[model samples]
Target: YKETLSGPTRLISIDGADHTFGSIPWQEELFSNTLEFILANLS
Candidate 1:
């Protein structure tokens, strides 16, 4: 499912993350990545 992006796509992986991020320890990393992505695309 990570092979269909058109452009400007990023695929981040949290070692122990699951589909729902349940009990995951990388939630902060997830949010940070998301925010960085958004900020970088802002014009």
Candidate 2:
């Protein structure tokens, strides 16, 4: 399924994180990584 993507792609897995990111630390990590990715891709 991922083979059809056209640009930069990433996969992040957080230990002990459920589908909803039910923990504070896991949520923080998810948000932090997402923000970093967005910033890096900005022109």
Candidate 3:
């Protein structure tokens, strides 16, 4: 995960969040950022 990104990439570390992101308050942010990234890259 750390070696692949050499150029354009976004790495967001959510504090107090785990891999599942279950029952977490910042889950909304995770979804929001994912949507934003997808929308931004769409052609």
Candidate 4:
């Protein structure tokens, strides 16, 4: 599924993270990765 993307793409999986990111550390990881992706892609 991820292979068909047209532009920049990122795949992240947080260890011990559930679907809802129901913990602080997991949520932080998610947010940090998201921000990194966004910053890297910005023109």
Candidate 5:
């Protein structure tokens, strides 16, 4: 994601088989994965 972006716009790319979607549903995993990645670098 780019910080210079404004408004409600968003973008991302996902690797379907990387995390075993068979176990984690893609819909719920969408923001979960992004949230974790973003928070990891917050500090």
Candidate 6:
């Protein structure tokens, strides 16, 4: 999430996830919560 670091634009904390919204474990709730941050801040 930092531009100063030399790497692609990254979303912090959520990485190496084997189970996301559409993944095998199907963590839609986690994804929804994470996504709500965007909506709340933006709104």
Arrange candidates by TM-score, descending.
2, 4, 3, 1, 5, 6
RMSD to native, candidate 3: 7.0
- Per-prediction TM-score, please? 0.40, 0.44, 0.41, 0.44, 0.37, 0.37
Give candidate 6's whole-model lDDT: 0.45
Residue-pair clash count for candidate 4: 0
Residue 2, candidate 6: C-alpha displacement in angstroms: 17
lDDT at position 36, candidate 2? 75
Query: After superposing candidate 5, which stretches have Cα over 4 Å from the reference?
Result: 1-24
User: Model 6 over residues 9-42: C-alpha lDDT tens digits?
Assistant: 2234346442342464444464556567666877
Deviating ranges (above 4 Å) for candidate 1 = 1-24
lDDT of 2 by residue, 1-43 (tens): 3331223332343332345455557656755687577779894
- The TM-score between candidate 5 and the true structure equals 0.37
Deviating ranges (above 4 Å) for candidate 4:
1-23
What lDDT score belongs to each candidate, Candidate 1 first?
A: 0.50, 0.50, 0.50, 0.50, 0.47, 0.45
Taking the tens digit of each residue's C-alpha lDDT, what string does model 4 give over 1-43? 3242223342344332344455557556756677677778895
Better of 1 and 5 by lDDT: 1
- Please report how far candidate 6 places residue 30 from its true position, in Å: 0.7
Q: Give the 10-residue window scoring lowest on summed lDDT in candidate 2.
A: 1-10
Write candidate 1's Cα lDDT for 1-43 as tens digits: 3432222343344333345455544755665577577778984
TM-score of 1: 0.40
Query: What are the per-residue Cα lDDT tens digits for candidate 5 across 1-43?
Result: 3441222232233353435444658644665666566667676
Model 3, C-alpha of 25: deviation from truth (Å): 2.3
- Give me the runs in candidate 2 sitting further than 4 Å from their true place: 1-23
lDDT of 3 by residue, 1-43 (tens): 4332222342344333345455655755755676577678875
The alpha-carbon deviation from the true structure for residue 31 of candidate 5, after best TM-score superposition, in angstroms, is 0.7
